[model samples]
Target: MNKVLKQAIRAILPTWRTTPVDVMHRESGIPPVAQLLEARRIRFSARIKSLDPAHPLRPVLLPRKYASEPLPPLQTAAKKEAAEEFNAWLESVSPLTVIVYSDGSLSEKGAAGYGFTVHQNGRSLRQGAGRLGPAEVFDAEARGALEGLKAALRLPQSASQKIVVCLDNIAAARCLRGQPSDSSQGVFLAFQAPAKRHRQTDIRWIPGHSNIAGNEQADVLAKVGCTHPEPMNAAPTLAFLRRGAKRQCKDVARAWWNETAPDKYRSLNLDFPNCCPPELDLPRPVLHHLLAARNHHGDFADYHERFGHDDAKLTCSCSWRKSPTHLFYCRKVDSRHRMRLAPSPAVAIDRAIGRDFEKFVKLAQSSSFFEKICPCL
Candidate 1:
């Protein structure tokens, strides 16, 4: 599959047969088939783990011990409604029920934090917040749910006291009701312990950024947690690990390119192993011209000679040897066009193929411009 995908990439890039596989892959901004399959497998595994107990494939995929243990029934409220309706519902909840509003925040530096405010009988009972180092926002959300449950359990309560945990993240709220499958499995499991003891516990999802007082307070506390001096030790979640793997892959590919890529390609100073090049979203023909020019595999006399093509012409119409660098100097091209290129050959090529790609595309699409630049094409 990888071999086939590489072949397709080469065709799309219109690069020479001898172009490095890594160069084609990077230029096309496509991952290896293996990497794609691994990502899919990870997603499928998470889905299977989150499946309902009654799902036929769930029993088959899971171990016998896990398959037989029925997931505890969790009361959930995830309906989408207007802010007015939600406020009305909140005001109508029984005064005896403990309402815990939880929220999660992610810092710019990748720190995750959780915060919760517990309330009852129209008054605040307590508030808590904490940081989880090097974790995802989803992990923080799950942690918030767990911590909120713990806080509600610690409150002085009568026999009729029930608990409702409200979270702004629907995914986190829903995940709590299902069997634990993600990186937050431990936190979710901890939440289940208290929830089982207090059978009247309910998990609810509220719209985020809707200006509710409790939700806003929880948001502020979560931001405070993000700035905490010390973060608690927490294992990296599956999402975090996947991101690391992707970065490592790119690093490896870049190292290989630096060591083995031809000097001609290296001179352009293009970002190697980039998964999303600027030209990627452009029209296919436009992208093809850019890649071909960058790789020096299109309409060049030296390229044709190297590949033993019959119609190879060593010199341009103005008698200069046809080469990748000759495009900026070709006298047949209009002085106006030449003025558009940078004085430095490397910068000129880089801009033509990358930085100024849209302009390059316009020129490439013009028959007069393309013919003057490369008559052999």
Candidate 2:
């Protein structure tokens, strides 16, 4: 297997200078090409340590046989009314439950990571981890749940085992379990094989960032796992794919703007649109109307002239044609009225338009009244 993989890597990687590994390491602070190659070779060559219960790495960190006989039961959040009743039942049934915890994390810098630990009978039976380059938080979370469940299945199977997979994300839980019982189904059916061996597999929802020990541990582990040299297993799910597609679209949009946007916009100081298109900051319909009017493409006088509205005259109330350029100095609208409502309504806006188009867009987003002066309304 190792030899076949080595041959495949050699065949798959590009020629030296243009190789992805070479380009990846060209960035400052990245490891040298030789060191990176060696690491990859070792990673691909070495047999992965299994997550089986008998594996040396399977035991919980700081393993010690506690004389306590059994650890405390993992608790789920409860409403005020059920708080007391829920704890009483949770402790009673914990011994029959194998609580599995999973979590994923993404840093502000876009680093993606996930971690999971399986504990039963007061001992962590297994721990699994993985990570990715900058990615969406939702994708990381979904992968955490999916891979955690898959890892739990690799543990020693027993008919007596009652697995309760705990994840803080409710949406991810619903996607996995399919339904409420051990029989719920969702996007992935990987849990079915483990279900047959274990008497039951339940996905339990817990509140995130609320300091639940298992959940917290999972969160911390995911963050730590982000530093791993290579991700363990990145299984793409529907959500992950969807996020990837959206990211691709954003990238394409940015590229188009960079390549084809007016030269005048080069000095614009604008924030990246994390959730929407670059130039659009309003609701879709409103954005459409505003853009049409600004570009002389809507039901304006200039547009009507070309499309032949009843009045084919190209003129505004101020005698200047109702066009985008005409709006700039048409005198149809007084700068004083707009000044009262602009971010720098009096004169700063015109300055921004000359020096920084992005700053103008940002200001424009907030001042619809001022936009009327230049079809920007």
Tell me, by TM-score, which candidate is best: 1
Model 2 misplacement above 4 A: 1-92, 107-111, 119-128, 132-158, 179-189, 231-242, 263-377
Which runs of model 1 end up more than 4 angstroms from their true locations?
1-12, 18-22, 29-85, 91-97, 158-162, 227-239, 261-269, 273-285, 302-310, 313-349, 366-377
TM-score of each: 0.69, 0.47
The stretch of ten residues in a row with the least summed lDDT in candidate 1 is 59-68
Report the C-alpha displacement of residue 201, candidate 1, in angstroms: 2.6
lDDT of 1 by residue, 108-221 (tens): 887788899998977888899998866778888898888988888888863358898888887788767666645667788788777877878878777888887888899999
RMSD of 2: 16.3
Query: lDDT of candidate 2 vs native?
Result: 0.51
Candidate 2 TM-score, C-alpha based: 0.47
